[model samples]
Target chain A: MNGFAIVWQERALFLEGLWNTVSLVVAAIAISVPLSALGAVVLVEAPRPVARLARALIDLTRCVPFLLLAYVIYYGLPQLGLRFDAWWAGLVTMTLYNAAYLAEIFRSAWLALPKEGFEAARAYGFRPATLYRRIVLPQIAYASAPLVGGQIIVMIKDSALLMIITVREISFAANSINANYFTPFAPFVVAIGMYWMLSLIVEAWVRRVASGARLRYG
Target chain B: MTWAAFETLLTGAGTTVALSLAGLAIGVPLGLALALIRWARIPVADQLVATYVSLVRATPLLTFVLFVFFVLPTMGLELDPVPAAIVTLALNTAPFNCEIWRAGLTNFPRDQLEAAEACGMTRTLAFRRIVAPQLWRVCLGPLVSEMTILLKATPAVAVIGVVEITRAASRIGAATYDPLPPFLAATVIYTLLIAVIVQAQRVIEALIARRYGYAAP
Candidate 1:
């Protein structure tokens, strides 16, 4: 069959894969961003040794390749009698990997905050939680909106690697099509197009958020 | 793990290192050319370069590796796994390095080139003398980070059956039925490799800074 016919015939499979990819990205971001923000706060506010240890752990996580990390979590965990489904493994790996990067981004944003802002909020009788919730956290979110968005884009791209562990994402679907039909070009080209389109949507969305944050905060 | 398994893993790590270096060696020059083409505002070439960079950046490296490994054979251009991995990686990396170089070029002052030209230097010589050194300074940190990324990506080549470090780790784990050891070993190797690159980056940046009579960033 021709490329168009092949794509049309497998439209449902492609759609399923697309849905899986989008959902995986959403799940990963939903979980990881908050963890990263918390880790960033700990890195900045924790005592010296605790912060140092946290920084080292973050560095170690960042150094290891995501694919290897996925393999370890998916296959290695089973051997340790702590098994997870392939999707869970993929989601956990993405969360852990991207959290390290996001933590770094957030930490920098936190450090860049003016010291006087914190003192002023304290002087205005704001409790610690209230100070963070009302003043500090909002500014960090606003300042790091662009970088956090970039990391999310990276998270989207990285989700494709989950296919190797049989998560049946778009790349996996493409591989199956290639193996079944001996048609390498159509499936992969379509997969790449899908990924590119996803990235564009993310980029546009991020730009809008960043501009909004700039206007609101500045 | 036994000495033999450790030896095998080391051999695989060597392949990983070599593949990353080879990819970067070719990709960096290609990236520089792409950056210069865009910098010159060459009408069609600039747009083509933009498309290439964006496409490469947006898609996963795994897809690009798969495409190079599979599609080239259909066009009567067969490549073995190693060559395919290297070619795919260089293709993947060039676009990123191009963007890095472009950023460096953008930050560089335009008047320096004019000054060099006024001093009777040709365009190429002007770039070499006036622009290249500062560009190298600005680009070195990002490029080193990119190299670490390329090194991390070498494992993706294992999909096409190149048997790099990560694949070797998996194989050994399967053989020994102890997945943790082999994978942990691979992690250590990768971390050490990246640490070396980071140290070397510091050294090179310091040397450049000393020569230019400025403190390193």
Candidate 2:
């Protein structure tokens, strides 16, 4: 039988894997976006010591590999009497890992904004919270959308690492198919194709969003 | 952690560094060749290189590792874990490095090459003397960052049974029944390795900038 035929016969398994990957990506982005936004804000606008500390923490976290970070969270946390299920552990690891990159992206966008806008908002008697909400956040969101989208694609790809911790993602499904049929190429190539398609869709969506934002905001 | 655990982790780290260096050694030349082919605008080859880069970038490094380590054996090209890891990493990194090198090439001033050719220099001589130096300067920062990324990705080889630092930590963790200490040690070691790479990048960037009589911004 051809490789595609083999993969077709295992369509259910592949679909399940794809679904798991999507779910993991969604959950991770939902958790990380707000957390990273807060982190970016602190890194950019907080007091000197606080900003320095946030920057250091983000740097340190980024230096560690995501696989190791997952392993640490999955295995190491149990020692502290804070055990989590493999799914939750994987989710937490993805959030923490991607949050650092997202925060850096957001921080750069925040830094690139002109200072005059913030001063103008302040002159209009807008407090820090209102100023950020009414002026800064919208600008950075539009400016950073493409990069944020790219990072989301990255998060989707990195979700495969969760299979190492036994999260039963697509890679895990592929491994099982490989083990059972001894057909490594079929399952993995299928998974890679799925990942590629997902990323292409994201890239297209991001492009549309960017152009739309340019027309609307500019 | 015990002294023995530290030793084990260090040994694994040594393997990680060695593998990463070997991968870079192969990948840099291959990537530069791809970039040059595209830059020369060899039509079919350029399209093929573009497709390769896009496909590789879209997939995770883990997939590459698994494919190389597993599928190749069926085609009678069996490899041990370390070499398999190195080959997979080199293949994965080549596409990224190609993009980086291409970006650097965009910064190359065309007039210098034109002038060199007008002055009777061979294409090879002109590129060797003029274009190559500036290309290295433009590419160095991104290349170093990519190397650190490749180094960080070394742990992915553990899935194929290679005992890199992360794998070493897991083994020690299982044996000692204390996962935190070994993982903590791995974190520190990884952080230090990245710090060294970043520092080297800065020093090299400064040196190149100085050689060109320009202060690094």
lDDT of each: 0.89, 0.88
How would the docking of model 1 be graded? Answer: medium
Docking class of 2: medium
Give the clashing residue pairs of candidate 2, or none: none
Candidate DockQ scores, in order? 0.74, 0.75
The digit string of per-residue lDDT tens for model 2 on B145-193 reads 8899899888888888999999999999999899998999999999999
Candidate 1: tens digits of C-alpha lDDT, residues B1-217: 9999999899999999999999999999999999999988999999999999988888888888888888899889999999999998999999999999999888777788778878899987878878886787788899998899899878888878898899999899989988889999999999999999999998988887778775324
Q: Cα deviation of A199 in candidate 1 (Å)?
A: 0.9
Judged by lDDT against the true structure, how good is candidate 1? Answer: 0.89
